[model samples]
Target: MNKKVFISGSISIKKLPKEAQKSIDNIINKNFEILVGDAKGVDSLVQRYCASRGYYNVKVYSIYDAPRNKISDKFRFEKVEVSESVRRKRESERQQAKDQAMTRDCDYCLVIWNGRSKGSYANILRAKELKKGLKVVINN
Candidate 1:
């Protein structure tokens, strides 16, 4: 079976350079099921691209419900939302569940950021700890 790949990156998709988009395309052509956070930026683009190509294997695991934007809603990717409570204990548990799901579902992870944000960095670290392969794509 082809490995499933998780995509972690900046939410600012509009800011991505042309070269970065090319790289993402190349990665997607590898036939791995793409998993993304679908928050914004690279994740949103990846999901949209996959959906447009009729790639039903693509999925998005989000921390919250879908954004109110039409672009986010247009993508036909499967989305799983994790609940976040005001309570620290509940939030921690929710985050842990997300991490666990990511580890189990992803065989590899691709990070597309010049520098790491909290969520992207944590995802990379978790992938590493779980011994999943890692790929980093940078915009120039």
Candidate 2:
């Protein structure tokens, strides 16, 4: 089976830096599967780039029943299930459900941080805690 990489980043990052693109290119060249979230900023940019490159081995994870933004409908959609308590929580808290699931499922992780996004930092910490090989690109 192909390796799976979780690509996550700060919601504040609206563009991909050269380093981030290079990391993505490496993953694509290796034909690894990609797991990404459904959010604006970096997530949307990544989705668009992957679609432009014709890389379809992607799964967009969401906490809701459907993704808010999926650049390529051909990519698979995964709705992570959380408990009622989590569902009732704040938006970021609820979103963590999907992030945790992706962290658990991926063999590797690529995070593009804008230097101050708590969510991106959390993903990095979670990946380290889970012992997944992780590369972080600081965009700021």
Top TM-score hit: 2
Kindly state the number of residue pairs that clash in model 1.
2
Candidate 2's C-alpha runs over 4 A off are: none
Kindly list the per-residue Cα lDDT of model 1 for residues 33-133, writing each as its tens digit: 76666355776676666666655566667545553222444334444455445224564345445545766688887777657455566777788888998
Query: After aligning candidate 2 to the native by TM-score, how far in Å is the CA of 49 from where it should be?
Result: 0.5
The pairs that clash in candidate 2 are: none
* Residue 109 alpha-carbon offset, candidate 1, angstroms: 0.5
Model 2: residue 123 alpha-carbon error in angstroms: 0.5
**TM-score of structure candidate 2:** 0.98
* Tens-digit lDDT string for candidate 2 (22-139): 9999999999999999999989999999999999999999988889999998999998999999989999999999999999999999999988999999999999999999999998
